[model samples]
Target: MSDWLSDQAGYVWLIIAALLAICELLIPGVYLTFIALGAAATGILALVFPELGAIGQFISFAAWSTVAVVVGKRWYGANPVPSADPDLNNRAARMIGQSVTVVEPISGGTGRVRVGDGEWPAEGPDLAAGDKARIVAVRGGVVVVEAVKAIEADLPDQPRDDQTQSKG
Candidate 1:
């Protein structure tokens, strides 16, 4: 095995690199990518210095693999924008500042509210059902609400006499 590997000519490392890349696709992680880079570097070295010994090729692969892993980790760590799904794990986070209605009375800082056809556990000051509230914040799937000013009812009946008596 050592003799065969040592006797190998150019592009053998490239074949190894291709195999590693395929393995990376199958495994679905950041590991094989570095190994593929290493193998590619080895192939380039072999192409440049055709008389390089097997030890030299091995060293080249190891060095390149280390470099690739370090650089990949640093690059990915610095910029971690969730590439998979933008809204995957943040449903309630999107509900902040939305207005909702109190479906259950909040007597002591806990209640239920209906927002967009869905009921959510809520926490805030006392709020009676049928009152309008706005989502102030969200924590662990629980919504926090603040009561808004109530809308006045439009009554066309004659209460002018009562208003005049109260003013007098």
Candidate 2:
């Protein structure tokens, strides 16, 4: 068994490396890339230094793999794209200052508001579902609203008209 294992040439290790690299393609992420690089190094070492024993080949593979992973991680870490909020695609962002109707009674800091065609979680003063509220702020995809007094149609339209009528 020892002889069979020792008899295995470096090319076999190199081939294993190539297979690992190909496999990395099917699996996304930085892990596979390191393994592939390690394998390629092993193949090169085997092709050039065929006399290296199995233990030596293994050590080389391990050392190269470790270096690859560390370097790849650092290189990737140095340049990271800012992650975008998944909820930014919603249409609520456009309703920042729009008036919305409360869909559910809000007590303390949580409630629901209907803006245009969509309903969103709201945070603000206590208000009933039928009350009208103006969106004051938006954070973490939650809308903040303040209750608005319902205007009565019976109120006079102009202050000047009331004064003139009183004078007459």
Candidate 3:
């Protein structure tokens, strides 16, 4: 058994590479795939250089693995995969620009506002309970808000009524 392994060391390396590739498939992350690339490169090296023994093959594998990881990092950094739903995990972030009702009077720039089916801590100008507000931002799980009346006040002017008179 030992003599057979010694004679077919290149095939052993190829088998190791195949196993690593299978593991990469089982795991979705690209980390295992990079390592698999290193193993595959080592197997190719062993096949091309039969005189390179176990020690040399190990050194080659290590060098290739390091290179693979560095290149993978750079490649992933340069072209990040965009998420289908950027706010999928961040519930608070999704609340931005959404309207909320004041569940408690917001005094001293702090209170609670009802957003969707739940209430969230709010920070904004003073507002009495029952007033409406819009979520402007989210800070540390708190929703920063602006009064609806204030937002409407910032809109362009309405039509003039100089020519209008009360019906007689």
Number of the top lDDT candidate: 3
Candidate RMSDs in order: 7.1, 7.9, 4.3
> Which regions in candidate 3 have their CA more than 4 angstroms from the true location?
149-168
TM-score of each: 0.70, 0.58, 0.80
Estimate, for each residue in 25-138, the C-alpha lDDT of model 1 and write its tens digit.
999677899889989988988988988988888998999999999999999899875656565668787788898989999879999999898999999999999888999999
Off by over 4 Å in 1: 1-5, 22-31, 82-85, 116-118, 150-168
Q: Please rank every candidate by lDDT, starting with the best.
A: 3, 1, 2
Local error of candidate 3 at residue 29 (angstroms): 1.2
lDDT of 2 by residue, 49-159 (tens): 877877788898899989999998998899875758644766566567788999988988898988887889999999987899999888888998988887878976666
Model 2 per-residue lDDT at 72: 88
lDDT (tens digit, per residue) of candidate 3 on 1-168: 987786777788778888888988888888977787888888888888888888998999899989999999999999999999999999888999999999999999999999999999999999999999999999998999999975354768665686465657
Flag the better candidate by TM-score, 1 or 2.
1
Give the per-residue Cα lDDT of candidate 1 at 94: 73
What's the TM for model 3?
Answer: 0.80
Highest TM-score, which number? Answer: 3
Query: TM-score of predicted model 2?
Result: 0.58
